[model samples]
Structures are given as C-alpha cells and as structure tokens.
Target: MAFPGERSQPRGTILIANPSADLYGSDRMALEAARGLVSLGWRVVVTCSVDGPLVPQLRAAGAEVVILDVPVVRKSMLSARGMLSLGRDVLTQLPRMRRLIKDEQPDVVLANTVTLPFWTLAARSCREAVVVYVHEAEAALSGLARTLLTAPLRLANGVIFNSETSRRVSGWPGLERRDRARVVPNGVGGPPETLAARERLDDMFHIVYVGRLSPRKGVDLVVRAAALLRDAGIEPHVELVGSVFPGYEWYEAELRELVDELGLAGHVRFAGFREVVWEEFAAADVAVVPSRLDESFGNVVIEALLSERPVVVADHTGLAEAASGFAAAVLVPPDDAEALALGLSRVHEEWTDYRRAARSDAPRARRLYGPESFHARLSQALAEQAFPVPSPSMKDASWSPREVLD
Candidate 1:
C-alpha cells in the first residue's frame, strides 16, 4: 500500500526483472538502461535467465545482477511442460523475490519488459507501487500475463510504455495509463569507432537484416525477397544477424530450406548471432527490417542510420513513423518481397541522395536519441513517480518516432 507520496522512506532502490536475454534489441536496451541507472548512483538489481548474453556486461556495469534459473518462452506453445515451467516461474522466483524484499526493501520494482511482470506484481504487494516498462507494443500475452497486467497496471503507481502505441495495445485507453505512462524513448550508445565502413558499396548491393529469425520478425520475407531479386537478374547479398531463441529451431530450419530452394545459398548468409553485430551492419549497403508484427520501437533501424546506412522497413508498426522522421530511411509495404527488392535496388542506384540525408540526420539523432537523453528522461520519470512533477518539450507528434534502445 505504499502509493506515491504516501511513504517516508528516504533510501531508494529498484529491481529490474526480465524473462529473457537472447541479445536481441530489447535485451540490449535493458542492459544499457541498467548500466545507465548504476552510473546515476541508484542501487539497481536485475534478474533474468541464468545463461544470458548480458550477465558479464551487467556485472561490469556495477549492478547486483542475479541470474535465476527460470523457464523462458518454450517452443511447444501449449504443453504440460510449459504449464510446469510457468508454475516454476511463479513458485521458484516468488520466494527468491520475497527474500530480496526482506533484505533490500526496494522502493520501486521496475519490470524491464512485459513478458515477465508477475515479479513486479509480487514485489509491489510487498513494497511500493510497481513501475512496468512495456517494451513491445502488443506482445502475445498468455492468459496469466494478461490477467497479471490488466488490473495491476491500474494498481501500480506508474507504468512506462515505450510508445503511445504500446500503452494503447496493452488496453489502457484515454491515457488512463498516460497520467503515469510517460514516453521516455530509449537511448543507444554511439556506434563503436571501429565499425567497418561499407567498403564494397560499388562492388555489391548487400541487404542486411539484424534481428532474430522468428516468424513474426518476417525473416522469410527477406528470403522470398532474395528470390525475387534473383529472378529479376539482381542478386543482392543478404546477411542475417542474431541467434535463434528457445523453441524457434523449426523456424530457423525453415528459413534455411528457403535459402536453399531460392538458390540464395551464396547470396544469403546466416551470420550466427554475433555478440558485436554492428560490424555486419557497417559492412552492408542497406539495413532491412521486414518485421510482420511486434516491433514497438525497432532500435536496429536507428543503429543502421547511426552508421549512415539507409534502412528499408515494413510500412507498419511504429517503424514507418520512425523511418519517416529524418527522411534517412525508406518505407515499403510489410512482407512485400518485390517491393523490398525494389527498395534495395533504389538504395544501390541512388546511394548519393540517401547517404546525404542520413549524414544530416545522424548527428541530430546523436543528441536526441543517445544515452545522455535516455538517462535524463528516465531519471526524471522515476523521480516524478517517486515524488511529483510535470512533463516535456513537444507535447506529442502524431505517430512520430519513439526510441527503444537502453
């Protein structure tokens, strides 16, 4: 019952809970946010799967990161094992969370992502109002996750959604979550200075996609698009970055077969999940985001633009709005292979104009979407919810760009 301004606890702490760590955009962003929070001198704690790509980075960032053995999203959607996994998630983590409550007594419980916010509900019951960060605009929530968020979202002192689209998708309409739902776009670290500049620009028309090979991500669209290009006497080199998640092996295999059937064996390469993925983006002429659904704020597109690379995105979700802002990117119909292929060719044909636009937009993004702004906005939101205050510069832009980095 520790609602905002109803308690007198001076010392404050926050626990960030997540159910995954597959080195995807969301996971990467969570790591950045955690590290930024620590630098701000806030005692932070993060709990996720025991074997995540982020553990070492978390430890280095000066956070008390605890890797808990929990069941993540299983491949077999509805199975006895999945039910048992959910039970273990609730039972196993609940006690560990109870113990942390007694020891640290955090002032706020901030669930980093939506998929695993039961931890927030549990922690809020013991502590203050929970602050849940909704990263995905519309995640396929299980019955339990749906029940968990609906009422408690109202119960929590605050909710921070990545975009207005996300808050609405979660069913908090008319800004019911808006009073507390502050939109603090993610901040990305500046691309490494050593990122490989595109040297084979004239030699090859390479199209790169940097995300997991999941069905919703629309990697198949890229596969099909590659075939379309080949048919039209164009062979664009396509590179895929990021590893397969649990239960997504079948999808990965299907993608592999599609690559073979399309005769794109040499043209399309599966660069199996590298830790540092920017180098691949750097080496390509264009970055492609062929997502069919669930891209609340596609961070990869911005990263592509950061390197002065043009992007071809599905003309839906928040990405289209994102791509339009700087005029540094191109918007094509979602999952349209022919359109995607045509877009790729245009980037090759008119490289000068696109690169010219990206050069102007990249610096503006550095100030607006970089780490400094993220920390500043997040700090203010946490403080405002913890205390009380008002809000930002541009009130709102109708479907404009919103970030989701760290």
Candidate 2:
C-alpha cells in the first residue's frame, strides 16, 4: 500500500545491498532491485556472495559491487547435513563481510534476503541506515534458518520486507531500535520487448513453475499434480524450470521419482534455469506457482502477468494477497493436488481474453512493483525515516488526534 501513490517525500544515496549473486530467485531479485534503485537516482551498492550468475549484471547496473566470498549455501529441512553445512559456511564467511563493511561505509546497507542478515551486523557502525530486506528465510529466523542466521541480524536498523507474510513469518514486525519494518513488494521490470512479443504465443498453453526443486518450495507437489492430471486423462505438458540448490539433491531425486512414477515422463520436463524466459513464456500459456510453504511473494507470477500469461497460483502467503482481484491469475490452496489440476485446466480452457486483460493491466501492476516506488521506499529505509514521528511543525499545523494509543 505504500507504493505508487502512497506519496511520501523522497531522498537519494540510499545503499541497496544484499547477499551476493543471482543463482537463486531471490538473488536475481536483488540485482533487479539494485537496477531499480539506480533508476530512481540513488547511489546503489550491491554486496553479494562474490561469485554467481549476477555479479557482472550488478556491475552493469551502475552500482558499486563488492564481492563477499561468503559461502552462501541453502539448507534442507528434516536433516542434519544441511544445518551443519550452512552453519559452518556462514560462520566462516562472517569475517570476510567485516572487511567489506568497513570499506564501504555506505549511508544505508540494504541486506537483500534473509540469508545475509550479517550485513546488518556489519552495518552497525553505519547504524539506522542498515535496512535488512527480508524475502526468504535465513538460518536464524524460524525453524532451522533461525538457528543459522542468529548473529548477523542483531545489528539491522530497519527490515524492509518483500511481503507482509514474510515479515510476520520472520517475526520482525516492529521492535525497538532496529525494529523499523516496511513492506515494499518486489517490482517487475524486464525488457518491454519481452512483454510485447508474448502475443505471438497465442496458440500454445503454458503451465510454468519456475523455482529451485526444494522441499520448502514444494516442486514435488507440481509433479504430483502432473500425475493427477494424467490419471484424469489430461495430458498437461509441464515445463519444470530451475535446478536444485546445493546440498538439496534429495529433493531433486524425490521430484524426479514422482515425475517418473506418475507416468508423466514425456509430459513433464525439467527445464533447469534459463537466463531469460521470454521465449519459454512464448512456448507456454499459463504460469503456475505451487509453493507449499513460506513464499514471500511470487515474482514469476508478476512476470507472468507482465508477459500477459494467466497465473494459477498457490493461495497462501503473499501470492494469494497479490492475486487478489487480478484479472489473469487464479488462486488455489497450497498442497492441494486436486485444486492445482482444476486451476490449471480452467486456465487453459479460456486463456486469450484474460491474457489481453492481463497485458493491459500489467503496466499498472508494474508501476506498483517497479523501481520508482522501490527507490523512494528504500531510500527512506536507508535514511531510517520510515513512519516518521510528528515534530513541532505538525503540532503547530494540526490539533486533532485520530485515535488514542493505550
């Protein structure tokens, strides 16, 4: 709600910082966030795990890039290897981030994603300007992630969330000194050409799900739904995208087996990760987000809307909130294979008009999710000016109180 015409005064030189690289969806979002901040005339500096698909892209976005050789690893649930692996790797990387922190001395250090709350700790000397952008779970927040991310998040000034759901899940709504939290949903802005060319894919129907094959992400649920579709005699050609995050190969094995067991071998294909998915969108008709738990927001759903592809999304978390009244997207409960199949079938049955309406309304949604709003909001975070308390000027101008607090 604080985006678009929420209309607050703005500033510049805000630091848009986060954990390194774009190998993951949230990481890719980090780069896009940096580009957006720069577009709004702010001095943006990105510090991520030094190696990944996004380092060069961040450099090209006119932001100062510092590589923190943080061994950023993803942990799997119901296991010990993932926990120990993440703890050891992140603990080792902690000191490396210290050197970068002292050197940058940025106005505000925006820690993109929950995984790198350590950046918040590093920015303590900078203070107030350390905005921790919480999109995904870190090692220290809840469940197992909380145990790992414990140390770094201690020094964060404000927490900027990608969705209200993520903020609530993280339990950092608004505390004290470092309790400032703002929910500025991630924006959608790729090449306009990607969107314009989507009309040519008018004939084919796509049931696209883009994300790593992880237990938490619930990629296997989609595979199961594919099987359910097969049982019903609907041959839904599923384009499974993204690879497994490191140390989570078992999740991949499970998904692969489910796909095989359901007799959907030819119907379902693992497409891995694609640099740009405009062509993939062209080949498909609808976007499917079937995450089982804790998705802050579904960027693919927004991107699908941009490409004018109708979305059938999991109805929990921010995805449900985002899909509210959107003409092109349909919402179904998470983990409900029956509902997933029903939604998918309904979308392909009547796709054209929804696609056109989606394209028409996408710009409005894009504006809500784009850089200008993000910059102004993030600038405020760096400035530590979120929810400004009224001063003498306000007392002099107005004399009425809306309500009494306690």
Give the candidate number with the greatest lDDT. 1
CA lDDT of 377 in candidate 1? 73
Residue pair clashes in candidate 1: none
lDDT of 1 by residue, 13-69 (tens): 767776676667767877887787777766778777666778777778877877765
Instruction: Output the TM-score of candidate 2.
Output: 0.78
Q: Local distance difference test, per candidate?
A: 0.70, 0.65
Question: How many Å off is the CA of 154 in candidate 1?
Answer: 2.2
Using TM-score as the measure, which candidate wins?
Answer: 1
> What is the Cα-based TM-score of model 1?
0.84
- Residues 1-406 of candidate 2 have per-residue lDDT tens digits of 2322243433244455555565566677777777766765556767666567787887888778776666543444324676566666667766666666556545456767666554665556434356677785332335555645433544565666777767666644234335566777776664456444244333334467777778767677777777776676666788988888668788788887887778778888889888777677756777788877757777877777777678889888778866766888888888888898888777655656666767775776677776567756655554444224445566446432111100
Each candidate structure's TM-score, on Cα atoms with residue i matched to residue i, is: 0.84, 0.78
Model 2, total clashes: 18
